[model samples]
Target: MIYSSEHFSISLLQPKDALQLNKLLVSNTERFIRFLPKTLEENTTLESTQYYIKRKIKSAKKRNEFVFIIHDKHSIDIIGMIILKNLDWKIKKGEFAYCIGKRFKGKGLMSKAIKATTNYVIEELGLETLQILSHKTNLSSVNTALGSGFEWQATLKDEFKPLNKAPLDMELFEFSRPDRF
Candidate 1:
């Protein structure tokens, strides 16, 4: 299902979206290098992006992970992506990882995208808790999480390790639904 607002739309990443997704990542490579290291390496080429998308589609079908594309409302251009991963079915929990093109930042787009995806996890998918981990210094991500209604939970020291980079500290933010009770 697709979610939308006046500015953008969000939906499952489809096979045909490989090219657009690749472009988005290529353009945002430097910005993503620190937090999205593995993702950056996975989509470094058109063919690799195709493979990544296929894997994501299969993962979604298996209910293990999901990748959603964020697009401009006026066109099909992919501007960002949100990943629902690190899922723990037994604990009813999951973590979100996201990124948008540099041109799309500072416009409140990611925050809305996060909220829509979070609703899908908590309401439709019946997950009880959600988390977003970002480097404490990444104010944009930190603000986006807070804006999307996720509360600061804790600081996880040395929680993120980028390729060949020193381990970095991350701030954990969480949102949980009580309706399951």
Candidate 2:
């Protein structure tokens, strides 16, 4: 297990999780389309989801990115995903992106998962800096970053552009390995 909480367990996303992963995406279509358009496109069909999982596994093998699935503790149903992407090996920097099915929102799973995963990325993967980027209007995401100990860095202008929408400013929240003063 990569991490566990009272009601969920996180682990490397496996090829066998395609069906449930697709279901999670299908169920959250309305909620995820704005920011997670690309991800949603990947899971729009079971066959596509399977292919996506294979690609993700290969990417993880190359250390280009990492993907974890959040499963319900009881049934092991995939309910969410957390990914470490945009890796910069030269600088030991990476960015985090995550999403949960609408049915599982407001449950603190994301906040806890992000905190635990950040620790794993820094301690085990040797990354020095991790970033959580959110649109300024996303209060819940911003709060998740703050609650997980990320410090507000800056507002990146035109950092994100939702499909069919104007570009948006993104809030940059960073979590870096603390200095040993």
Candidate 3:
């Protein structure tokens, strides 16, 4: 399903998005490589991006994960991606990860995506809690998570090992649906 607003839209990443996803990754490699090391390693080409998209689609069908790409409402250009992953059916919780192109930074696009996705997770998916983990130094990511209503949870020690860099700590943030009972 597609989610939209006046400025941008969100849709599931499909095989048709391979070329745009590849270009986005390549153009923002330096900025994203650290956060998306595994994804960058796997989807290095258009063919690989297509393969990745197919896998994600299968995961969504299985109710395991949902990945959405953020696009400009007018131009239809991909600006970022938001993923609801690590879903635990028993616990009613999921993990989130998001990234935006450097050119699209500081525009509040990701914050909107995160908030929209969180609502979908809670209302449509029936997930109670959504968690986000970001490198402590990534102020933009931290701010986006906070602005999206994810509260500070904890700091995980040596949570991420970026390429060619020392192990980094990650701050965990979480949002949970209010109790109805």
Best prediction by lDDT: 1
lDDT of 1 by residue, 34-138 (tens): 888889999999999999999999999998999999989887689999999999999999999999999899999999999999988887888999999998789
TM-score per candidate, in order? 0.96, 0.96, 0.94
lDDT of 2 by residue, 1-181 (tens): 7788788988888988999999999989999899999999888999999999999999999999899898998785788889899999999999999998877888787898888888888888999999999997888788888989999999999999999999999999999899722
**Which runs of model 2 end up more than 4 angstroms from their true locations?**
none
Kindly give the stretch of ten consecutive residues in candidate 3 with the minimal lDDT sum: 70-79
Model 2 residue 47 CA deviation (Å) reads 0.3
The TM-score, computed over Cα atoms with residue i paired to residue i, of candidate 3 is: 0.94
Candidates sorted by TM-score, best first: 1, 2, 3
Clashes of 3: 0
Query: Candidate 1 has which clashing residue pairs, if any?
Result: none
Model 3, span 1-181: residue lDDT tens: 5678998888887878888888888888888887888878867998889899999999999999988898887775788898888899998999998889888899888999999888877998899989999987799999999999999999999888888999898999999897833
Candidate 1, run of 10 with poorest lDDT: 172-181
User: Which sections of candidate 3 miss by over 4 Å?
Assistant: none
The lDDT, on a scale of 0 to 1, for candidate 3 is 0.88
